[model samples]
Target chain A: MKKRLLYFCKSFKINFDELEIYDKDFIFGVLGVLVEYLSGLLMMFFIYDFVEDINGWSLDQVLFFYGLNLVGYSLWSCFFINTITLPYYIQRGEFDRFLVRPESPLFQIMMDSFDDDSWGELVTGLIILCYSWIRLRIPPIYFLALPIIVVSGCLIYLGISIILSTFSFFTIAQADVANITMEVKEFAKYPLTIYPKVLQIIFTVVFPIGIVAFIPGMVLFRQIPWQLLLVIPLVAIVFFVLSTRVWYLGLKHYGGTGT
Target chain B: MGNEIITVNRLSKQYHVRIITEGNIIKRIFSKKKYKEIDALNDVSFSIQEGQYVGVIGNNGAGKSTLIKLLTGILYPTAGQVSVMGRDPFNDRIKNNRNIGVVFGQKTQLKWDLSPLESYDLLKTIYGIDDETYKENIKKFVGLFEMEDFINNPVRSLSLGQRMKCEIAAAFLHNPSIVFLDEPTIGLDVFSKDSILRFLRSIKEESNVTLILTTHDLEEMNSICDRLIIIDKGRIIEEDTIEHFTERFTCSKSIVFCIEGDIWKDINPIDNEVLIVDNGKVIVSNVRKERVNEIISLMLANNTINDVQIIEPNFTEMVKKRINEGD
Candidate 1:
């Protein structure tokens, strides 16, 4: 356990040093994050200006939904962005380096690089969550449940990213195809009712982005019962485990057929 | 020989490659079911004992990379068994990796943005190398590879030799029992190649680590390797000591002439044995050892010579000739 901890800590240190994101660079990254969040917040406000609510959801509820998305996406992209580069690695046989290393292949791939953009998104997410929490006058029960909610939401996002990127192992495709699937989050950012009926069902059952943070936001808005939140973590676990299993299965295919 | 640290028994790997012969874009896209099976490696077997330095040599697409990948746990064998340190390399990858180091030619294993020191620190953690040992190995490698000047620079910013030295240092930091080098000297300058070969030679006596090198340069075999394992068409053609292999196969001497621009431009095709390389017009003529002076005189009589030397036929050319002669 001690050795594992040592490796984990050192992976992070090496990643940070390699990324070379200095104080100034990090501050600029934060600014970019804020610009994106504010633009998203502005779009929501514009929608609220014309209509009183989106399917009975007020501006505050919309803000909470948006913030939840940013939080989930930040956590997922922070760790799993490198999965998008799977095709490049597989094509060049650079992925073999991960296999020869002592760490698990997935662990090495994720820790190989650090996405500096995520740190700013986390700060922005928390501020929005806190602002919406006070304005909604939500109950204290959610604060205790927030960590669990975030974990499950992040896992769902991470799982989907992995499953989509795993296609690179078999195909000659690159990151663009996997990146297109990420647009499903654009649907999750808004209230489910705001989308077309097909998109609603698809996000709910097919792509399952609805569960990432949007479902829990609905609970706070009283659109769904709190018990539905119980389903989120379970789905996250199953999805995460199955997606991870698929990654290893992809490795099996890659091993059998050299690139 | 000491204990057999690595062994392979009838190991093979098959790849199902998709055949896209149809030129019709729509049909090609739709009818994607065609695949042809190829045996990248077939029924190959070998063993290396402790502290032995072995070189794997072959032409392109002769199952060399497949064998390396299989032994290193990067690829799984389709049939038979491979044991590295008493464990199946693919099945027990993480454990097998603990005692092995790998360096591939022209492959950037170190992170581009990180310095060698930073990369070494990461390896130390990944391999669980003790602090004292890590420091000691780093110092030794720095001295041997002469990487002190560029050790702190980012890998991308360093010269090829500097970067390669760093990569080799990173591989050895953990002091693995065996080190696998795949063309570790390709594209390196003569000075860098000399230094790398010298380092590998010195380390054998001091470290006692098994070395498995896969390469095109047979000349390197003389410098650092003990035995040569020649593979052709996915099979082991020969395995023998350097002396025996040299004595039997190196029958023809090569006269290489570096002549001024387009020296062979108007000259008629003289012999199939002469190979013309582009830059500097390096003309290498493989003939009988007795005809070395004859070839040199012919080359010198026609053009202004930049350099001339008599050398042994390179491994690929020698193997090609030997195969053609049915030897």
Candidate 2:
């Protein structure tokens, strides 16, 4: 694991050096990310301004959930956005290069590229989370668990990304499916109580997007039992293990054809 | 011969390729998967001793790439066994990979945006190379390939030949005991090809690294390889030392003689030898090596010969003749 982390850092440094060659483009990319982040925040504000409470959840509580979702998504983008390129790798016969290496192929793929644009989303999310925390007057004990919660949330995103990208092993045209599935996770920005029972069930058990942010939001609001917080780590582990299995299965079926 | 570095016993690889149809989406999703098995490699077996330079030659779809992939553990074999350094390549890939280097000529393993030096540093970390060994290998390769001009340039900015040099250098940074090069000189210009071939020759002379190269260029093989293996239709059709392989197919030689005047009527053809005269020249075919002097004397005795030339069959011709014989 230490070696893999060191390798990932080396890969990131190489990418950063490459980005330096075109400083203008790098700056423009960061600016575009900031605009996108502000737009998302504006959309959340627009929805909250029209309603006093969404399913008995206040604007402050929902804002916290939104911040949680952004944190998870941005962290995932920073680390694992390269998973989206899995289809291109398979189609172009680039995956064979990974197979020849002595390290884990999955780790290599995850570290292939780093999305620097996610830094904007990460900063915005942190600001929002701090504001919501001050407004809600949450206890200091909960602060200790915030890091754990954020990491677990990112794990859920990582697991889902792995599962989605693994589909490319079977067919190269799986990027659309992966994109749609990822977009669907955006619905988790709101409280799960407002959605239909079926969707809530699916989000809890099938996709687990609700567990990523909504449950943590409930904990912040003091509406759910603190014991329920343990579910975050438990769910994250189960999801990670299951997704890793799927990834290995996909790898086993990789034919490396067309080259 | 040194200890065997690679061994194969009845190795085979078969891919289940799906045949897609322009059917309805529902049918495509619900119907049972349909596949046609294509044998990329049949029951093939060979062994390579350490420090030997072997060249693999085959036509397109002749299983050259598949065999290399199997040996490198990039693809699992469907049957039989492959052992590299006394370990099963597929089952012990990480361990087996420690002693082997692979280069797919059409592919670039270096990061496009980073310099060769950066890529080399990344590999040094991945392969756990000690600083001393890393510095030694990098300095040696950079000097040997004369890559000082572009070693620090981004890989994307480098020409194909330059990038290929870096690629080859990167593969050798770990000082692997065995290396596999698939068409390493493809698409290279004459100068670049000469440089790469020279580099390869130097490596062969200076180190104990075993090399297995696959290429369509028979002349490249003739220059560097001590042994040759020819595959056709997913089977190993021929394998032998380069000298023996060339000797077995060179059954006849052509001798051409230039004459000052027309000698067609004076020169009589010998039995079991073909003789033709065209435009003040006498052409002799199917002449044995030992009979060259006798034939030359016969021609000189009858007609004045100005110039004489002898042409031996080249590697390409020998390969063509061998494949045709198999067919």
Candidate 3:
């Protein structure tokens, strides 16, 4: 694992060095990310202004949920965004290149591409989370639990991505499926109580997008029992293990048919 | 001979492909899932000794790539057993990969956004190559392939020939005992092909790495390979030394003579041996090795010949003939 991390560092450094050669393009990419980040925050503020309270949760609480979602999403994008291209590689028969390498295919895919743009989202998410934490004045215990929640939330999001990426092995037109499932996370930025009951159930159980923010927010608001917070880590582990199994099964079925 | 580096016992691979039927809207909407099983490899078995240069040749869909994939553990076999370096390749893929290198001519394994040198550094960490060995191998390959000019350039910016050179160099950086190249010279220009082939030959002489090359280019096989394995319909039809394989397919030679006059009508044939006369030339084929002098003398005495040439069967022709015979 340590060696794999080192490999990621080495690969990312190389990518950074290459990006450095195109200084203008690098600058544009960074600036574009900042613009998007700012625009997204502005949109969230506008929505909160229109609705002072959503499903009994104040604007500050909703902001905390949004911030937590960004933190989890950004963390996942940092390492796992490259998995979105798994279907393309399979269709092109390029996945065989990974099979011949000594490293795990999952690890190699995670380390193959780095998203520099996600750093902007990450910093913005951190700042918002800190700001909302001070405004809400949650318990000190919640502060201690924040790191664990973030880690668990990242795993859940990554697990969902891996599960969707595994579908590429079965069909070529899986990009839409992944896109729709990812877009569902957008609903998590608000309180789950405001959504329809069916969507709330789907978000809580089937896809579990709420684990990133809604569930953690409920724990912070003391709306749910503290004992239920354990479900976050448990769900993360279960989802991760199941997704990994599906990935391996998909690999076994890969015929490597196309050139 | 050195120890056997690869062994196969009746290996086979079968894939289930979906078959979709064309029909009306209603029928298409309710289309049933239909599958047809196709055998990519069938009971094929062969072994290669360490340090041998072997060439595998077959027509399209003859299981050349399938065999390589099975050996490299990219695809699992439906039946039979394969062992590379005394380990089950599919079951022990991670361990097996540590000692083998593979190159697919149709694909690029290098990171497109990064330079070859940077990619090599990442691979070095993956393979755990020592600092001294990695530096020495990189320097040697860069010098031999003349890649100093573009080694640091992004892979996307390099020409196909330059990228291919870097790809081959990257494969050999770890100095594995076995290397599998599938059409390594495909899409290369004449100059690039010559340089790559020369480098491969030089490596053969300097190292004991076993080379398993699969290509449609019989000229390359003839030039570098010590042994040839011919496959047809997913099975090994012929496996022998280059000399024996060529000898088996070569039955006769042709002799063409440029005749100044129509002298074929004047020459009385011995034992009904016919001479083909066309466009001021006489041609004779299937001449016995010992009868060459007799045939030439008879032609000379009868006709005024301007030029005489003998044509031996080439490797390309032999391969074509072999495939035709199989069909």
- Output the number of the TM-score-best candidate: 2
Position A22, candidate 1: lDDT? 68
Compared with the true structure, what per-residue lDDT tens digits does model 2 show for residues B59-139? 998999999988988778888999999998777878887788889999999988888999899988888899999999888
**Candidate 2: regions farther than 4 A off:** A172-174, A223-227, A255-259, B20-34, B257-272, B277-282, B289-307
Task: Report the lDDT tens digits of candidate 1 across residue range A1-259.
Answer: 6866776677767666645546677668778978987897788778788999777888888778777777777777776677677788887768888888887888778777767777888778878878888898889878877887787878877777788778887886454556754686677777787788888888777667786667777687666878888888888888888988998898888887778
Off by over 4 Å in 3: A21-52, A139-142, A223-231, A255-259, B24-26, B254-284, B287-310
lDDT of 3 by residue, A74-179 (tens): 7877667777778877777788998888988877887788777677777878888888988998777777777777887778777777888887877855354554
lDDT of 1 at A187: 73
Q: Give per-residue CA lDDT, model 1, range B265-300, as digits (tens).
A: 333334546666767766555465555666667777
lDDT of each: 0.79, 0.83, 0.82
Reference contacts preserved by each model: 0.83, 0.55, 0.66
Classify candidate 3 by CAPRI docking class. Answer: medium
Residue B179, candidate 2: C-alpha displacement in angstroms: 1.3
lDDT of 2 by residue, A226-258 (tens): 778889888988997899899978877774443
TM-score of 3: 0.88
